[model samples]
Target: MGVFVASTRPKVVVTRNLGPETMPLLLERDDVEVVVWPEDTYCDRKWLLENVRGATGLLVMLSDRVDAELLEAAGPSLKVLSTMSVGYEHVPLPELAKRNIRLGYTPDVLTDAVADIAIMLALMASRNAEEVTAVVRNGEWPKRPWSPFMFCGPQLSASTVHPQRTAGFIGFGRIAQATLKRLVPFGLTTCLYAGNPATPADPAADAAHARAFGLPRVARVGLAELAAESDVVFVLAPGGPATRHVVDAAFLRRMKSTAVLVNAARGTLVDTDALVRALRERWIWGAGLDVLEGEPVIHADHPLVKEPRCTLLPHIGSASIETRQGMAKMAAENLLGGVLGHAMPAEFTGTK
Candidate 1:
């Protein structure tokens, strides 16, 4: 009689340490073998390629590029790719689709977290938190003179007695709408959004959104109008070739001097060079940003870092403990489902 042996279990390669809350989801699974980078930071590219040679599943982060090179390195056994992010710009869709590989991502879970940050950025920029906080941090407040209008920029709030304040959004999607809902309580009277011209407008939906927020005005307008009229403008547009550097020199020049700019979206959407020039030239009041172009590689002498009028965060929009854990759990489920030939909890279905 010939002796029989069991087949080896499929492997899943994770880019980074998914933390205590999420790591167990895969570690506890007896059906698959899991390999993690074991570091809190980004996984080394060289190590990733070497380990993913025969992985049936890959759990990646936004920092890891899911391009042709990485896909090819993963070999024929690579059946699923999951990322703990809402955006899929880092993933090469065409390549994944061509290979018949399933792709999964976390989306709505981070919407509220990002929206909260957007509002925080708006206040930080408008209130000159960067400069004022620096005064105290550098111990200059003791020596500095104070005045009533010393740091005044613009008010985010508007009352019935005061002039109405308008909040403009570059892309009025889920996050944008959630942000608007928050702003409604802060006395936001008007809302304006500018979306892709290719996408047909829905007047009925817009009307319903306006009614829900009890805003007197909510209209879809062109970029020029949004930049000019907005008291505070939020750039929530997706990043790609089409929307790259949408807020360039021309758009900056059109904005009101008192208008504050808040960008929690992709960094490439706003040209960094143009923004530096705008801040230096005082084209607008100030700016707050979470994501920036060429981030994680920013030098100490980077131009934005030196600019006092700009408040910058190192891409911590969805860093809330609850949201991050939720995203990771969702991503793990997605990878497991795809590997088992089941429907993913949140599969990428291409752009609507």
Candidate 2:
């Protein structure tokens, strides 16, 4: 028998340290040359461009943009582009498609992690967690005594018999399903969802999801119905032109005065200005946001920053150490899958 050798070991460039557990998976391949970025920090564009030259695969984070210029810099050898994130908005898809680059991303892996954060944000925002923390930290707790409705917000587990106890979802998907599972224990009985209609293949997935969650009914309602009926509306949709500002002024206006809003999906899905206005004007009860539109560059004076009713997180939806490590390992697999000409274990089929 003749010893088989790979024609040429494919060159792989990982933009960051994918954690200790994942490095072994990439290193086990005998027919691959893996080059990790030197620093434990984000790779600069110039460094990425220089290092990516002549590479066969590129594993990146959402911070790095896989645009046409980067693809050109990488040359025709670039076969795969995998990101360690569920969202692909940062990647230049058309450019990648033009260059015949395969795309891979971690989607389902982080669903449960993100859903847990969403529910936490909803609870924190509704209960004024930040304000309460500030009060306790500032030594005001000893000065002031607890009183009825002093820092009270809407009760999430309040009796389902009340018509005001509905939960709404802007985009219902796997994460939404997981979130509903957590909410059912809180007495959520009615759920309203708005997104692309259910398909024939998964004809009853939506209905089945409702039954599994123990919700009395789950219907695909229009944006208006979702806004008007929900006591707590969660924005769990993707970001893009079509779904941008899905929670604008008009939608916010329709929400019940006591309703709470939670967004753990994308920041661009809601207009921050409109949300600030809604909170200031009492259009909706409050808002909990894990992701912000402009991100780390959010203005210090942004209205949401000053609004007491809004709870803002620094985009830590997938910050759990275990979940992050899993995502990194999955992303490495995706890149290796493309390099080895095998189907990715978790491949993105592209936007429908």
Model 1 bad stretches (over 4 Å): 1-7, 159-161
Q: Report lDDT per candidate.
A: 0.91, 0.86
Task: Let me know the TM-score candidate 2 reaches against the reference structure.
Answer: 0.93
- Candidate 2 lDDT tens digits, 1-352: 9998854788999999887788888877788998888788778889988989889999999888778888899999999999999989989888888888999999888888999998998888778887788888899988887799788877887565563467899888889878988888887778888876443324387678777777778888888999999988999988888888888999999998888899998889999889988999999888899988889787769879888788888899999998999899889989989988999978777754
Clashing pairs in 2: none
The whole-model C-alpha lDDT of candidate 2 against the native structure comes to: 0.86
Locate the minimum summed-lDDT window of 10 residues in model 1: 153-162
Clashes of each: 0, 0
lDDT of 1 by residue, 102-200 (tens): 999998999999999999999999898999899999999878788898877677888565568899999999999999999998888899999988988
**What residue runs in model 2 are displaced by over 4 Å at the alpha carbon?**
1-8, 160-164, 197-206
The positional error of residue 149 in candidate 2, measured at the CA in angstroms, is 1.9
